[model samples]
Target: MFYRHDNWRVGLNFKNLFDKKYYESQGDWIRSGAPFTVLGTVSVEF
Candidate 1:
């Protein structure tokens, strides 16, 4: 979700909303993905 107003801005983001478990494999290497995460931001013009 995101919002903006008169030279100002706000935003929110989500990576894994369900918090599920998963893995990745490349060649002979194995890795795991991230869990539930959230991000927010705010900005303004000069």
Candidate 2:
């Protein structure tokens, strides 16, 4: 188990932010980054 700061937190979250799809036909057409990626950020003040 792990514990992190439990203070006022301001955060931003994104899930499946990008709806990218890859098909076998386009096997080599995939981008360097993964599809349906997520991005988040958190800030806290004690």
Candidate 3:
């Protein structure tokens, strides 16, 4: 969560929130996961 004034900025983020299903390995080559993500951000500065 994030918020700011003056410069104008707002942000919120959430990733992998209870998606639960993982498997990642580089040794034997195994990857399966990452399926639930939500993010938002806005910024302006001049």
* Poorest 10 consecutive residues by lDDT, candidate 2: 1-10
lDDT of each: 0.92, 0.53, 0.88
CA lDDT of 36 in candidate 1?
88
Q: How would you order the candidates by lDDT, starting with the best?
A: 1, 3, 2
Residue 2 displacement (Å), model 3: 1.8
- Residue-level lDDT tens digits of model 1 in 1-46: 8899999999999987999999879999989988989999999998
Tell me which of candidates 1 and 2 scores higher on TM-score: 1
Residue pair clashes in candidate 1:
none
Q: Which is the winner by TM-score between candidate 2 and candidate 3?
A: 3
**Best candidate (score: lDDT):** 1
lDDT of 1 at 22: 90
lDDT of 2 by residue, 4-28 (tens): 4777455555544666555433655
Number of backbone-clashing residue pairs for each candidate, in the order shown:
0, 0, 0
- TM-scores across all candidates? 0.74, 0.26, 0.35
Worst 10 residues of 3 by lDDT: 15-24
> Which digits, one per residue and each the tens of the lDDT, describe model 3 over residues 1-46?
8899999899988877888889878898999967789899999999
